[model samples]
Target: MMKKPNTAQTILSVASCKMTRAILRKTGRGGTAIPGIVAMKAAKNILAAVSEGMEIVVVTGTNGKTTSCNMIEHALTSGGHECLLNKSGANMLHGMAADLIAAADWLGKPQYPYAVLECDEAALKLVVPYIRPKVIVVTNLFSDQVDRYGGVQNVLQEIRTGVERSPESVLVLNADEPLSASLARSTPNKVVWYGLEASVGTQGNVDLADAGACPECGGEYAYDYHTYAHLGGFRCPRCGYRRKDPDVAVISVDKKGTDGSTIHLQCDGVIQKVRISLPAVYNIYNAAAAIAATKALGLPAQEAIDSLSSVQSSFGRLETFSLNGNRVQMILVKNPAGCNQAFSYVTGTGEDYSAVLCLNNRTGDGHDISWIESADYEKLCADPHLKKIYAAGDCREELYARLRKAGASEERMERVSDYHALVEQLKEEGHPVFLLPNYTSMMELRQAMTQATGNREFWE
Candidate 1:
C-alpha cells in the first residue's frame, strides 16, 4: 500500500508531470519517460492516487503489447467508450506515470473510467500494483535485450514477479507459450488464454530446438505444431504440464503475406471469421490476444473481433510507405524471434522486392549483434525474388558478412553506410523495398526517411 501523500505532494506531482512534458516537447525531446520520472520523484504514490477508481488493463511481454493495447483501445473507442492508453511504445514505469498524470485532473485523480496501459515485461512489477488493472495480458516471451534481462528465463521471472504482485488482476496469457502459460500456476489470478492452435508454417533456418521446455519439470516439450517460434501445442511427458485450451483461439489462418490475414477465431464456443489488416503469423497471435483481452474486459466478442479489421497500428513494425517512388515497408527487428518472423513473412510471400538490412549495437538495440546469427537470415537471402540486399547502419560490415554467409551472392549484395546514400539507392529500386532495422537504427533512419517523404514524427 502507498502512503497517503499530503495535498501539497499531490499537487506538486501532477504539476511536475504536466510541466516536464511541456518543456520536453518545446525543447524537441521525447516527453514519454522523463515526465513520469519527474512526477514520481515528486510523489511516490501519485500513480496509484490518480489511477484509483479507473478500470484498467495492463499489457506486458516481449512482443505484441503495443498492438494488443491498440486493438483493445480501438474496441473500447468503437463502442463509444473513451479511454487512456500508452500508445507511444513507452511501457516503462515513468512513461506510464506520465500518461496517467497527463490524463488525470489537477488534484491527481483520473478523469476517465478506463485505461489500457502497455507495461514493459521488466517494468510490470513497478506499475501493475499501482494500477491494479482489470486485466493483464502477457504476449509470448523471447530472448530480448539479453544484456539487460539476462535471458528468457530471467524475463519470464520478471513478468511472473509483476503478475504475482497483483493477484487481483486477471491474467490474459498466451496459452500456446509454455513459458508464459506457467504464470497461471504461480499466481492465484484468474487466467484468460489465447493463441493459435495450428502452425502457419514450420520452415526456417533458426534453431529453436532447445527453446521450450516444461517449466515445472526439467523435461523437453513435443509440439503438435508451431504458429511461430516456440509457441504452439506442447505437452511435457514428465509433469503433464501442457498447453491449455484457449478461451479465445485462432482456429485457422489464411495469410496474405504483407497485405494481411484472414483468421477463423473461436470465442465462447462461437467461431468468427476475422480479417486482420496486419501481416505475418505473429500478428495473428496479436489479434487473438486482443480479442481475449477485450472480451475479458466485458466488450462483446463480435465488437472486439470487428474492431481489429480497421486498426492501422504500423507505427514502425511492418509499416510501409511510398518513398522515392518505391513502396518501402519498415519492419523493426530487435530479437531473433522477431527477426525470424520478419524474414519468414517476407521470403514466404514470394513478392519481388529488394531489402535493406540495418544493424546497430546501441543500448536499446541490445549491445549484442551476434544474435543475428541465431536469426534465419538464410531464409531471406535464399529468396530468388530478392532483387538485392543493401546492408546499412553502423554495423553494416557485420550485416554484410552475415548475409554473405547466409547464401547472398556477392554480385547481388551491396553495402551502403550513410543513411543519405541508402535513401538515394532506394530511389533507384523498381521492386518493393523491405527495410529491416534494429531499434536505434530504426530511429535514425526513420527520421531521414520520414523527413524525405514528409511523414509525421513518431510521437505525433
Candidate 2:
C-alpha cells in the first residue's frame, strides 16, 4: 500500500499541480508539462510521491516507444487491469511527472494499479530513479535527435544509466537491435529479449547504419540477415558479443499488406498465429516488444496476443481518416529508419496515391534537418503508383529539393505552406493520400487535417 504525502512542501506541490492543470484545461491550452513543472518547483520529489504503489512499465527507445507503450497498455487493459499512460507523447521528466501527478488524487495517491509510460531516451535517466518501474522496455535504438543526444552511442549510454538506476526492474529489449541488446551487458537486471527469427523480406539499402560498429570493440559487426537498418542477426567478430536467442520471437510473417499482417510468433516455446492490426515490419517489432513486456509482468500471453488484433494506430503513426470521399493516412517519421519504413509501406500498397511531406525544424523536432537526406526518397520516386507530391511545413523547400534530387518530376511537385490550404487541396484530389510528417509538423498538420476531415482530436 502507498501512503499519502503529508509534508508541507509535498502538499503544496500537489495543490499547485492540480490547480494549474485545471486552469490550463479550461483555457484550451491543453494539459501539457506546465503543471508538472510547477509541481516539481514546489516539491522536487512530487513524482516519487505520486508514483508510489504502482507497477510501472517504462518504454524508452529511439523509435517505437509511443506505439509500444500503447500496445502494452492495451494488453494490460485487455487482461482486466486498470492502467494510466502519458498518451500525449510527452515523455520527458516534466511531462511524465505531470501525467503521474494528474493521474493521482489530491492527496497524492495513485488512482491506478499500473502505469505504462513512454519515456524519452535522454529523459529516462531523470525519470527512472523516481518511478522505479517494475519493467523497462527498450524498443530499439536508431540515430534519432542527433543534434540533441549528440550521437546514437550517447543515447544508448543515457538509457543504460536509466536501467542501472532500476536494478530490480526487468529489462525487456529488442534482440535484433545490436545497440539495444548491448545494454543488457551493463545492467544486472533480469533481461528478456524479443525479435524476429524468420526474415520478413529482402534487406534493402539504407543511407546510414548507426550500429555498424560493435559497442564492445571497434571491429565491424556482421549480420546474417537484416530486417531494416542495423536491426538483425548481428555478431561482433572481435568481442564475440551477438544477438541472444529471443524468449519471444517472431517465427514468420504469413501475410503482410498495407492493412495489417498475420504472423507466427513463438513465446517461450509456444507458437501462436497472431494478427497485428498495424502495418509495416517495424510494427511487428512493436508487437513483439509489447508481448515480451506483458509476459514479463506475469500476464497471460494469449490475452496479449489477442489484444494485438484490435490495436489501433497511435496518434500520428499510420492513423487514417476519410476526407472528401478519399482516404488519407498519416504516418509519423522522425528519422531515416522510420521514414524508410513509411516509404516502403506506402509503396507496397500498390495503389495509386498522392503524397504530402511535412517537415519542421522546431525545438521538439531537433533543429537539425540534415537527417532527412538520409531517407531513401528514390523509392518513392520510382513508384509508378505515386501521382502527385506536395510539400508542407517550415522545411517544405528542403523536402522538395530532396524529392527532386531523388528523381521526382518538377511538374508534379507543389509547395503548400498553409496547412488549411493543404487540407483543402487534398480534398480536391480524388486519389488515396499519404501524409508523412516529422515530430512537430505531425502535431500541427494532424490537428489541421483532423479538424478539416471531422476526425477526433488527439486529446479526445
TM-score of each: 0.96, 0.97
Candidate lDDT (C-alpha), each:
0.83, 0.87
**What is the per-residue lDDT of model 2 for residues 65-157, given as tens digits with 9 covering 90 to 100?**
989998999999999999998887778899888889888887788999999999989898888888889999999888888899898889888
lDDT (Cα, tens digit) per residue for candidate 1, span 166-270 = 888889999988788989988999988998878776647435543657778879988788667777788887888789999998888865567788988888898
Best by TM-score: 2
Evaluate model 1: give its TM-score.
Answer: 0.96
Displacement of the residue 156 alpha carbon in candidate 2, Å: 0.7
Model 2 weakest lDDT span, ten residues long: 1-10
lDDT, model 2, position 268: 71
Deviation of model 1 at 112, angstroms: 2.7
Candidate 2: segments with Cα more than 4 A from true spot: 1-5, 206-208
